[model samples]
Target: MSCRVGSTSSAPEGLWHWLGSIPHWIYPTALRRDGALWRQVVLWISGICLMVAVTGFWIGVLRLRWRRRYVGGAFTPYRGWMAWHHIAGLVGGMFVLTWMFSGWLSLNPGEYFAVRGPTRDMAV
Candidate 1:
């Protein structure tokens, strides 16, 4: 059985495919060079994404106070809020994850995956 990491089970097919292919994509991008403007954009997007992700995650998870309907659930009037919260959190989390990695690379272009100078060839 495939490990349903994070919110994978609920993720859309297209997104799932992309996420599945991350290992293949990461290396190439990690080594590639990015321009200054691109880096700024990445940083801005990452910041926004992180904020949205955290807020949504909190909202999504906080609703867990209400358990099974038949069982003794949390005594709250707004029980249905959980579903929407989860959806919002999932969406936000996806964007946040992408933005974060890309932003890190953009911010530290030289540091991330920087290839060292060629090593001197040892005499045979």
Candidate 2:
């Protein structure tokens, strides 16, 4: 079976194919110039994406009206790109955060979250 590592099984064909790649690919950093610069670019972009996703999602949640609808009887009190941003933020933010975080973790800048090797007495 094909590993559904980042599958969009819920969406119908021709709709979710492109969006389905986000979680798996996250960013096209790997396809960039293969050198030290690429690593830094990935780290920076991942960190930024994670932060933006978190903050945007939080704001969207705050502005989301489940019980009392908005002016147009809509759940969101936004229109145009704002509306798309709000909706997309709520829907795709989580996935973006997940993939971005995983990408960031792989980079592990400053070695802050880096794990030390097994102890001498530790079993192989």
Candidate 3:
């Protein structure tokens, strides 16, 4: 039989019931309930951090390119495309790295890993 919210029929236990009641748009496979103010704060902070890292990378690339053209001063004077390419690649790489790390931390909080054993106290 189809499931219904707040139903008392042959439904799953507390955890499963809670998981099933989540909205479909956010989580079709499982429930994703709204978080408290703290969680929202963390998310916003992570987002801002990601943005800062990306911006730094972009600026670093620009600095590197400028340094190469004026500082290196290759006698032959080759095309400047290589300088731009090298800096852009480095910045993009760093951006992706920061994004992945922050994303993982956001998905699972630190407390989740602090659990020692099955019988360990979870109230803390």
37-88, model 2: which lDDT tens digit per residue?
Answer: 6667767777877787788779889998989998888889999998998898
- lDDT for model 1, please: 0.56
- Write candidate 3's Cα lDDT for 5-122 as tens digits: 5666445554465566543123333222445544555555566766676666666555553444553564223347865665565757676866656674755655575547665356
TM-score of each: 0.37, 0.49, 0.34
Each model's total of backbone clashes:
0, 0, 0
Instruction: Assess candidate 1 and give its TM-score to the true structure.
Output: 0.37
Index of the highest-TM-score prediction: 2
- Listing every candidate in turn, what is its Cα RMSD in Å to the true structure after a full C-alpha superposition? 12.0, 9.0, 14.2
Which should have the higher lDDT, number 1 or number 2? 2
Order of candidate numbers by TM-score, starting with the best? 2, 1, 3
RMSD of 1: 12.0
Question: What does the lDDT read for residue 9 in candidate 1?
Answer: 57
- Which of candidates 2 and 3 is the stronger one according to lDDT? 2
Which stretches in model 1 have alpha-carbon errors above 4 Å?
A: 1-34, 66-110, 116-124
lDDT of 3: 0.55
The candidate, 1 or 2, that scores higher on TM-score is 2
